[model samples]
Target: MCKEECPYDFRLAEVVSKLKEIQARKVLVQLPNGLKKYYPILRTTLEDLEIEVFLSLSHSWGVCDLALGEAKKTMCDTILHVGHHGQVALYTLSDIKIVCSPAFYKRNPIPLATRGLKLLMAKGCKRIGLFTTAQHLNYFQELREALSEAGAKVHTTQIFPWMPGQIIGCRFDTIVSNLDRKVDAYLVVGGGIFHGLGLFVTTNKPVIIADPYSNRLIEVAEEASQILKKRLFKLMEALDKKNYAVVISTKIGQFRLALAQKIRDLLRGRGKVAELVVADEISPSLLLNIPWAQAFVIVACPRIAIDHQEEYPYPLLNPGEVKYVLRGSLEEYTPKDSLVPNLSLNNVA
Candidate 1:
């Protein structure tokens, strides 16, 4: 991709200034796949500052996925991560410094917000809840003003780490629970169906996605329900499996060994064969290598099971869904906000 055509503000100057403030001689640069195209510009810019930059080839799903180990191994002074908020910066780790530089989308959201407002009004929605991802967070006030002026009651909440109207792939429960009853419909001013579906599954409200890229307003209630049905089917299928492979990711922030062990022990207590599988990257091919295990339970990221369910031939379940299997009922079947049971520094690598 061309640097001139890049739509996101990578805040390269801010990152360079921070590195200079810390007097970082060598640094590790990591970014999500979507932002990797700007690597050449990033590398050349930092090289001009006489900073030795080592690019991490590993994939980063979010701020939760950091390259701390890589930075440590390379003896770098700091790790500059792009494309996500600085939520992880709240926690202090070992010697290596972490700088989370967010990449904000430069696209105008007024047109998409106008389209969404019309759809929400057409649905007879008076009370509206607004949300978005990090990239589109800048448009929150603008969209909220547009909706409020249209005689719609708008509500939003800011949970620590996540900005107001911002939702990650796996986190939206707190924001939804706080405003679910107050709002008639939820509008996600961002790209993709993931965030919209996340809100729909967590609450009983109609979820609308204002995709600036597609220039369309989409309601994900039908699609989210379809996904829930598939998850329920997978959960039911997993109940009968005699053996299971519980997986734990080794990512700096995604590691959940305790939860994996608890799930493994839970299976063994129920007289089922359960083995712990440790991996840096979780994929169908990686799990398929172990044919003995009939089904798989990943205690890491829940999106892996929900978003990539088609890749695996067998039942792929998350830790939260495992409860329905253990209880032998579908009383509380929903995607979780946290990857592990109790999200804390202790549980992560």
Candidate 2:
């Protein structure tokens, strides 16, 4: 079972066994929207084990609210949070058990035959835009230089504001808004279809996704490609569309808002329309004046608001660059993003 090609094949059994060992009476299960498709199987598996389960779904901020709420209610003896890159906080457990599935896989190197990259190079791809899951953001600099030497320009926006070291799944609007129209195509160097699909949803131009574990570039197949094509056409038709606004807040003594301002300047320079709504703590109603934005971006130091109990209604955008931020100033803390090769399932939990 451990050697199964698809980890899902044996994961439930393993989870059940672990729960039994802990004598877990109740369990909490949290997942992102992307993984909602698999909830039926998960629910059935937990019920078979005779464990009471609570389900919570978050679009971007993984496990933060669910974990906190579970902690307050003392509702479960075990917790399982899935569909994230393994950044879990806001829940403290001295005795209760907690487990998380870090969906990390190694992909084979991308082949050079993909039409998107080929077309991009032909069109003189001097500058490139990059975004990824929060855990992988540390590698962006190396990736940037790699693409630069490959003759592509590179730019990255710390999209999520509140959680710096985690990926903000819901706040992809910032990435889309920051797209360099001057660049030939967008490059997403992360796992799964979500990252690629997010960028694809916002632009008609080419998007080259390099997931080393998946070993394939997401391209438009004749059938599935039509959906991507339609999405791209819609985004292109909506070009120069300014239907959204974002409010950025910063942590005390952290430079998150400064970086966000820089990103704002970059977006404006590219001729995209955007407005800085508010940069301070305020009610959700503060956004009422912005004319109903399509999305919002939050920029703050890692773990700043994790214990603060602040809440917001909009989707968040975290940069996943906490290590870099901390390394530049504080020396006592080890940056979580340090390179550790050949990541396995154990590394994620």
Candidate 3:
């Protein structure tokens, strides 16, 4: 039984059974920040089962940020990754048992969906594109039914490596391109305006965030427009910059050496000083040390440039924004072409 202390279902019983089935004596436990408070529940359960648990204190951004290396170093045969799921690769690749235990929120999303429906209908959004984060996926069916019962045509897609109607921060372009033509507006059933803003910017369509935690309907059209304007200003500043540093992530799943190499070559070809900077985590303070580059182009996750631009003193450009620096024209941006390809276990790092 799930404890009353945590609202999310950690599926402790299922995890214990799996560990027993695999005869896993030593296990590594991983949890995202939001789910860290309930780590004691998981740790206690695992300890009761005589499973040696090693907790990872590293940042758990997504399924991509698995603690496989940590498990290897600690001699743990299995990894219990919590809070997200549906993107697991086979154990053949890692030679270790990787169990993904996704935490599902116990709260119903219908109330927030009903409120968002009214807002979406008021904006004349009859065709709704539905999407949400991994935690809210358990309520996806009921939320879709609520929208359809209200006379809205709902469109959903099972994007590779993502559940039906699921959206990751980095893959907004892939999601928008697949559903933009099919829907009039997007209704994201998640916690914040983060995914909603991504959809609005990518498709240039109206987006409604059905926040279950706050029980509110958030319209992100205006916010996305403001973000676009800021990005345009940054891109304009990038055009006149002489030196460039293209950042490539060293994270297992986010590593994109090929795209970073392409950007470096593109800048050097234009008679600009360019070099590739490798990093495990990209932050403003870390980049501030490199004083030579006037601007930096991120080839890892595109959201870093769009959402966290104010933190950096210099202009931060995504791979799609690099065209403005090269051609000196603000043509239509299609991140599908410039960014790295879709992720798969075989291709990561």
The lDDT per prediction is 0.77, 0.47, 0.78
Q: How badly does each model clash, as a count of residue pairs?
A: 0, 16, 0
| TM-score attained by model 3 | 0.90
TM-score of 2: 0.41
Q: State the lDDT at 131 in candidate 1.
A: 76
Q: Which residue runs of candidate 1 sit more than 4 Å off their true CA positions? A: 1-4, 86-92, 331-349
**Predicted structure 2: lDDT:** 0.47
How big is the positional error of residue 279 in model 1, measured in Å on the Cα after superposition? 0.4
What are the clashing pairs of model 3?
none
Ranking by lDDT: 3, 1, 2
Q: Residue-wise lDDT of candidate 2 within 135-253, one digit each (tens)?
A: 35445455555656665666666654533323343444455555556565676666555455545544545666665554566642232355434423332333334343434543222
Question: Taking the tens digit of each residue's C-alpha lDDT, what string does model 1 give over 138-181?
Answer: 67788788878878899987655456677777756677567778
Ten contiguous residues minimizing lDDT sum, candidate 2: 336-345
Model 3, 202-224: lDDT tens per residue? 67677888887888888897777
Off by over 4 Å in 3: 86-92, 333-349
Error of 1 at 222 (Å): 1.8
The clash number for model 2 is: 16
